[model samples]
Target: MRNILTLAGKDFRSLATSPMFCLIAALCSVMWSFTFLRSLILFAENTQATFNPGPSPTLQMTVFLTHISQINLLFVFIVPALTMRLLAEEKKLRTYDLLLTAPITATEIALGKFLGAFGVILILVALSFLYPLATYPIAHFSFPPLLAAYLGVILVASTYVAVGVFASSLTQSVVLSVVMGLVFNLFLWFLSQGAESATGLYMTSVLEQISIGDHFMAFIRGSIRLKSIMFLLSCTGLFVFLTQRVVESSRWR
Candidate 1:
């Protein structure tokens, strides 16, 4: 456990020192903030012009929450890029052997890298809080749904990071890892759409259950369902387990 923690700490420091991390973080933060603020301003302007009153608290909260929820699709792409190098870069540089020679098992090394990547993701998600905070002065602003949306975002992003880590473990090229992660995500998206178009009720239900966008839409609308929470957790666990298995298999080579 101590060795895992130390490894996780090292991974965290390496990510912090990397220019790619800073560049992507800055890009996501700025783009999301700009889009969200634009929506807020447009909402306020429309309300004042049409209703002869300022935006209501409920509406403001809803808009902000929706923006936060919807913007996670961006993180879906960005997280893979962040995690793609977690294992691939280590392998490419031959540092993975040194780590493996230490007290840490393959599972610990894989999981520690995942946790460190997740920590970086958590920080990025937290940075989006500025959107909700901007609505603090409004009368109808409630923090509960915003908190829930943030939770949902973190859950989804964590799952993506785990998936990317698994992809990274499959190959020693960061670019391949990124492409695999994106392809996997895109495939799920297509599955969701195809399931929706199927004729049978059972098929449609199954598709909705697996639809990442469908599950996230509930949280975006300030509604939390047990199914969505379970889906994200399941996805995270599945990918993390796969990553450990992949890393373990490589040890016999």
Candidate 2:
């Protein structure tokens, strides 16, 4: 346990000092700020303009979910930047040989790197809360759904980080790692889109079940479904496991 945390801390420091991390973090801050403000303004306008006061706008759209979901799509670009160096750079600099020789297991190394990247992602996701906090007096957001939406974003982002880690493990070139991460993430994200054009119920159901977007909606709407949570956790674990296997193979070779 101590070893894992130590490795995670080391990677986190490495990531924090990198220029790419700064770029991605800055980008996330700018985009999320714009989206949060826009969503809040629109929600306020719609509330004042409407004759019927329906469900709480806070509940209706949930401030974070309103635009965060779209910003979440940017993970395809941002996660790769964050994770491309985890293992790839280690290999490129031949530091991976030293790392493999150290007193650590492959699983520990994989999880540590993942947790490190994920820590940064958590900071990015937390940026979504700024507008909500600034506009709290007027917004009067509901805490329950707001928190639920936050959880959903974290899960989705973690899944992206996991995929990026796996992609990083596949190659030594950071460029190739980024490309692979983007392609893999794009496919998983859009996998649900195929359900619409499917000719058979089985195909449609299968796609819907595996679709990240489909599961993601339930949380954005402020409903926590057990299945959705489990699916995301499973995806995250699967990729981490794959990364560990890759690292293990390299360890033996």
Which residue pairs come into collision in candidate 1?
Answer: none
Best-matching candidate per lDDT: 2
Tens digits of lDDT, candidate 2, 53-101: 5654553375566676766788778888789999999999999988899
Question: How many clashes does each candidate structure show, in the order listed?
Answer: 0, 0
Off by over 4 Å in 1: 51-57, 60-62, 138-140
Pairs clashing within candidate 2: none
TM-scores vs. true structure, each candidate: 0.91, 0.93
Q: Give the Cα lDDT of each candidate.
A: 0.80, 0.84
Residue 12, model 2, lDDT? 86
Which candidate has the highest TM-score of all? 2
